[model samples]
Target chain A: MDTIIQTVTSITWQQIVMMVIGGVLMYLGIKKNYEPTLLVPMGLGAILVNFPMTGVLTQTINGQKTEGVLDVLFNAGITTELFPLLIFIGIGAMIDFGPLLSNPFMLLFGAAAQFGIFFVVIVALLFGFNINEAASIGIIGAADGPTSIFVSNQLAPNLLGPIAIAAYSYMALVPIIQPMAIKLVTTKKERRIRMEYQAESVSKQTRILFPIIITIIAGLVAPVSLPLVGFLMFGNLLRECGVLDRLSNTAQNELVNIVSILLGLTISVKLTAGSFLKVQTLMIIAFGLVAFIMDSIGGVLFAKFLNLFRKTKINPMIGAAGISAFPMSSRVIQQMAQAEDKQNFVLMYAVGANVSGQIGSVIAGGLLLGFFS
Target chain B: MSAALTQGFELMLFGMGGVFAVLFLIYLVCIALNRIFSGKPKE
Candidate 1:
């Protein structure tokens, strides 16, 4: 009876709060359809781990050590950095580099938009985080959840939960966040600016060679980024190779779905109340918004700056699509353009910049690893 | 500025510079490939 009472009373307010947060995440995922696949597993994991004396985590049983499934999964998948790399293969397979290949100049927006990662690192430092912690926190601006997890895992493992949540949450909120950021910086004229997209047909050889050359170039330039870029390009190679359709289909579907589940649940281990309920956690969340806003601003301003020299003006809003949130950011830009003026279609250009953002964020992650590690 | 602040600025410069440099190289490669392989304008 005493043992039962102790077990029942061991539940702290913090644990209850975490469980509620987890429930809210699940609710948001299921009802709102916001990253349901990731949020549902993460929410369930959070609730499971927070239950008093839960057996879901590794513990001593019968005076002997026994491994919990989540712990085993976390160790084998996340700590080894296998899950994110695997997810990259799926993401790489899904991406069609055609838009980007047609408009190669869009790559600059990808590079420019990453300014937030570095900018927020500086802000985080001022807020009293050490260089490594600051860098990890700033990576939330990468707008790529896997890259955020990969970088934070490498640099500041303790802050992984908040940073990962921030990255993904902000990614989902791109529609709300980016439009607000874009609206604040750009005038109505800039928002309504239309650029003609001439579909440049790329050769089959170029399609196949693009991934190979990019992987080689990125590896040579930033050797440390090899794992991040290599796996991504390898996946792209499988996709563009045209000989591995079955393998590509598996990578895009089964492999990604399985790894995403493991990745979400394993990441939830970092969400224990003891680690999550901190002033630093709040700061990470706040700084993540800062990073995202800065990324949008960086891209927009760079585009505006370029427009000064070019006779044929580029739409400044396309720059905001350069963050790595993919179709969401691109879609937001398209909606905003239509809102401003009907019959203005810039989705192709936005997508070009958007896909380049995928490559940009990965390289930025690699560069951060090289500089800090 | 404090030592941490100084280091932060240095990292910002290096990080942004490195990203731009890498992406610029990729851009150049794409351009070279397009010029070399592409036949003529389709439309």
Candidate 2:
């Protein structure tokens, strides 16, 4: 009873703050539908870790250090970089590269949109973070949570919790963040620009070959990203091959769902108040928002630049889809297009650009790894 | 600019440039692959 009393009283204001944060995350996830699968577990885990004397975290028992459940999971999963890579496989399997295959030019928009990652690196540096931390913070612009986790885990492990939070929170907010950024750079006439959509007629042979060739190219270009790029493309191969439909289904469903639960909760181990309650965390979150906005601006401006040479005009709104929140960013672009003109349909192009953003994001992450790590 | 910020500018230059260069290569390769498989629009 005395020990329990001590434990209750030992809780600090910072712990209360973290618990409040955890509650807010849970509320945002449950009520607001903000990436609930990931955020819910993360929120619960944050609450679990913040209590003064929890067995979920590493503790000294009988003067001997005993690893807690979260620590063991973190070591085996996040430290070894297993969880993010596994999630990547699921992401790859779920992505239908059909639209991207129909319009390979969308790949350019995807690459162009990664401008935020680099741009934000400088901004983070100006804010007094070191190069590695800046890079980790900047990867929030990738808008690919797994890649953000993967990059930050290696580059700035200490900043992992904030980076992960910022990455995911901003990703869930893409619909709100992107439009304001897009509208800033694009005129209403540019928003209503339309392009013809071709039916996806990519052959099964091309489908099978696409993943394999892209992996090989990634290997040649950025061998360091081979593990990340290779696993993702392997999952795509499993999907496209049509021979391993069962495996692909398992990857997309059970494997992904289970891994997401573990990944979300495991990262929260870093969210203990001691590490997380800091001035820098708020700055990181702000930087992530800036990164996201810049990504939208970059893609939109690139489209406007390309429009200089084209006979047929391309919708600049589709360029904002290149920031890689997947179908969500693309959907926002489509909705905005409809808002501008009811008859205009840019869903196909937006989807193609959004899908390309996935590949471009990984490639951009690979490039950063090449530069920094 | 501080040395770190200077390095960052270089990063923006090369990083953005690297993404474009590699993706452009991928674009060329993808076009090549499409021609071999689909055969309609001239590359």
Candidate 3:
């Protein structure tokens, strides 16, 4: 009886704190609907991992300091680059490359948005982080969670938990972050600039060829990116191949849903209080914002440069969507457009650029690995 | 340290230039295709 009481009393304050944080995450998911798909599972996983002496988290190894279940899972899935690539496959299937095909110049916006990745990498390094860790932190600027996961897995596996959390958290907060950045950068008059939409319907053949051509080009140019890019493009191919409707649906909905649950919970298992509540984590969060802001700025500035040459001017606000947050960033641009000029335009152009960013970031990730490795 | 910074800077430039050139080549090909496949205007 005394042993049982002492065992109960042995539970630490840090575990209690993690339990509360888990509860808060659940409340945020159910009540506020802040990224419920990821947050709920992640919250539950955190709770499960934080339980005292569960023996679920511990493992016996021949020669190991302390093996935990999550540590093993992390090593297998995340450190090995399996989860992110699989997630990309689902993302690729969900994306419609038609908009991108209609306007290939949007690729420039995508490329430009990556300025933040390198920029923040330098800043992080200057702030005492080594090259790999800095690179992992900088990828948060891509406004892409999976790419961050993939890059960090390759570049800095130790930073994976914080990097993944920061990436996803910022992506969910894009609707809030991008608008303020857009508004601060562009005047009301510029924001209200109405542009005519060009009608360029892409053929099914073109759609089918796009993934193949892009894969060939990217694979040739940056072989390092093949895993992330290959998986993403393959997923897109599944979507665009016309006869593979069933596969595409499964990839987009069922596959993504299943993987998201597993991935989210797996990531959460790493979020122990000792690992999570750190000074570096705070800096990571701060720099992640900087990276995101820079990506937006890079896209916007590049669009503005294009405006100097092209007769058909694009709304600079749409450029902010070039960070690969997908429809969310595009939707923010659309909402901002509607607020400024209801009849101005929609976010199709931005969506095109947004998808292009998705591809471009993958390519960049590959190139970084190629160059660094 | 300065040398490392220079090397990093050069690396960054090379990357930026490399991707830019690739994007440019793709653009040129796209433009050329647009010109070739875009038939004469309907009478």
Candidate 4:
């Protein structure tokens, strides 16, 4: 009776607060339909682990040793970097890259959009995070959840929970965040600018060779990014190879879904009230928004800059799609363009930039690894 | 600037420069591949 009372009374306000946060995340996931698949599992995991002396995580029970399922999964998945890499395979399979291949110039926006990662690293440092922690937090700007997780896991494991939460939450808010950033930077004239989308047919051979050549280039330039670039390209190779249809389909569907569940839950292990309920967590969230906003501003400004030298002006709105939120960023840009003029169809160009952002985010992760590691 | 600040600036330069260089190379490669393999013009 006394033991039960002690256990019940030991529940601090911090744990209660964490449990409420978890509930809110679950509510957001189920009710609002914002990243339901990831948020639901992550929210549940956060709640489960916060229960005092819970066996959901590895803990010594009474006297005998015990290992929790979440801990086992975390050790086998996230720490090994297997989950994120596998998730990359699914992402790679889902991406067409055909649009990007047709309009390669969009790749510039992909590169430009990554500016926020480095910019925010400086900002994070100013906020008193060490260089490594700053880099990990700054990578939240990469806007690619797996890359953010992978980098934070490698560089600053202690901060992984907050960083991962910030990365995914901000990604879900891209529709809101990107448009505000775009409107702030661009004029009404710039917003209404139209782009001509020419449908260029890419050959089969080019499709097969793209993943291979890109892997080589990225590997050579930033050898540190090879695991990230390699796994992503490997998945793309499965997609483009034509002979691996079964594997590609599995990767795009079953493999991604399963890994996402595991990854989300495992990430929650780090969300204990001890680590999450802190001033730095709030600061990381704030910096993540800064990173995202800066990313949009950077891409739009670069596009506008390019217009200075070219006879044909590229619609600066496509630049905002260059963040690595994938189809979401692309879709947001397309919708924003349509809002200004229904006739403007920039989806293809936006997709091109979006795919390039995917690749750019991975490379940026690797570059940070190289510099900081 | 402080040492950490200096490192941060260097990282920004290298990171951005590296991304652009690699992606630009990819751009050029894609253009070349398209030209070589796109075949004869269709009527």
Candidate 5:
């Protein structure tokens, strides 16, 4: 009772603000449906850690140190960089690289869309962050939640909570954000550009070899990317290997769900009022928005540039789908296409681009790790 | 003229180049794999 009274009386304005922020995140997660699995737990954690001398973080009672679950989880899971990598395994199992393997041309858009990751490196640098910090923050443009967590955990751990929030929040908002950026740079006729997509027959050998070959290529180019690329492709190998359906099913369903839940809650360990209320946090959020928007613009503009030389004009919106926001970016592009003309069934092409983004984001993350670490 | 700016540009040039280089290689290899392996037997 004494501790409770002391905690209530001693609570600072920052703590109060953090609780409010936590409440807002909860509202968004529950009502607005924005990355609910992550946001809900993260919001609750924000509220959990903010009370003075909160029990969720390590505390000394009578000069005896007591371990907090959140802190323990943070050290075991995040500090070791285990959670996000584990999440990648699940993501890999869930993804079908068939869309990507069918059309090699779409892979270029994957590389092209990564313009935002490097672009934000400059933007963050201009904002006075150090190289490693800038690099970690720049990864928000990967638009991949796990990649963002993985890179930032390695480079700018102190900034993990805000970066994670920004990555996931913006990803959930892809439906809203991407269309705005797509429409700004594309013409109605460009949006209406139609292309034929025939389901190509991919050999089982190609399917099995695809993950293995890409893993080798990633390893050769950026050896630091091995853990990330290796783990992701390992999951894909499990799916494609034909003998591991049971394990693949486990990875896609149970493994992903459990890890994502823990990963979501674990990231909030960094969201304590003292760390999360800084001026720099606001800057990270802003820069993240820039990264997201620039990524879409980069992809859209790339397709437009290609149209200049190609005899068969490509829908510039297809380029925007190159963002690793996955089905959301793909969905946004297709929706815009259908809105312009209902007969425009760009969904299959968008799926191809979307899956390409899955690979693109991991490579970009690996490259950032190689450069900085 | 800042060190951060220099580093940023260096990253931009090489990073974009590296992404394109690696993915472009994958593209060529993917094309080859289709021709070499398509219509083959399953395991």
Candidate 6:
């Protein structure tokens, strides 16, 4: 009777708190439909990992110490960089760079958006985070989960959960965060400025050559980025080659789904209450917000600067697309534009810049890894 | 503290330089490709 009472009391407040947090994640997934694929599994994994006295973490078989199944999957997939790379392949296949190809200047917006990463890296270091940890945290600004994972794995694997959670959360909240940032930085006149959309149809030759050329150039320039850049370009090649429709379809759907499940649950293994409920995690979240805001500012400021020399003025609102939330950021920009003037503009240019942001963010991650390495 | 600041400054400079180099290369490649493939306005 005493042993049973002891067992009942052994389950602590912290574990109970973690369970509640897990339940919240589940509610968010099932009810709100916010990133359901990831949040659902992650919520389950969090509950499994936080259960106390389970001996799941310490269990051994045949006199040999072995990690629990989920922990093993986590370390093998995430720590080894398998999950992020596979996800990148799918992202590459899903992307159509036609819009960016038409508007080459969009690349500038992409590059500009990365200002948040560098700026926050410095700020984080001042806050006493080591260089490696700072790099990992700063990548949350990329508004990309895989890039954040890849960079954190290379630079600071321990911070993976916070970084990944922050990246995805901020990405989901982009619609809210970006408008305020845009409104703060750009006057209504600038938001109302309409740019002409040139309809440039790229040829098949250009489409096929792009992935190959970018792969070779980027791989040569930043050898450290080869695996990521190479695989991403390969996926794009599979897409553009027009010979592997089945493979492209698989990459976009089946392959991405499997990898996302593994990645989601594996990432949650780190959400054990002790590591996650901390001052460091809180600071990382705060700085992640800073990085995102700075990215918006950087992209918008760059666009404003360019307006000085150009006959054609760009809608500064489109600069928000530079944060690489992809179509979401572009959609937000379009809505904001429409809010000001019903027929003000279309979303194509913002979409182009958003795609450019994807490439730019990946390249920046590679460059950071190379510089630090 | 100063030493850390110096290192931070170097990293910042390197990061900025990389951004510039990358931006220039992307712009140049895009423009060059456009010029090469402009091709009689795609009738």
- Candidate maximizing DockQ: 1
- Per-prediction DockQ comes to 0.73, 0.50, 0.28, 0.63, 0.53, 0.48
TM-score for candidate 5: 0.97
Weakest 10 consecutive residues, lDDT, candidate 5 chain A?
A: A52-61
Of models 5 and 6, which has the larger DockQ? 5
Per-model TM-score, in order, reads 0.97, 0.97, 0.91, 0.97, 0.97, 0.94
**Alpha-carbon lDDT, every model:** 0.91, 0.90, 0.77, 0.91, 0.88, 0.83
Name the docking class for model 2: medium
Off by over 4 Å in 1: A1-6, A60-64, B39-43
DockQ comparison, 1 vs 3, better candidate: 1
TM of chain B, each: 0.81, 0.79, 0.74, 0.84, 0.77, 0.80
lDDT of 6 by residue, A319-368 (tens): 77987788899999999999998887759899988998888888888888
TM-score of the A chain in model 1: 0.97
Query: Model 5, which residues run further than 4 Å from truth?
Result: B39-43
Worst 10 residues of 4 chain A by lDDT: A52-61
Error of 6 at A7 (Å): 5.9
Query: Which has the better lDDT: candidate 3, or candidate 6?
Result: 6
Clashing pairs in 3: none
Point out the worst 10-residue segment of candidate 5 chain B by lDDT: B34-43
Query: Local error of candidate 5 at B3, Å?
Result: 1.4
Classify candidate 1 by CAPRI docking class: medium
* lDDT string, candidate 3, B1-43, tens digits: 4654554565566556655655655555444444445423223
What's the C-alpha lDDT at position A191 in model 4? Answer: 83
What ranking emerges by lDDT with the best candidate at the front? 4, 1, 2, 5, 6, 3
After TM-score superposition, the amount by which residue A363's alpha carbon in candidate 1 deviates from its true location, in angstroms, is 0.6
Off by over 4 Å in 6: A1-8, A55-66, B39-43
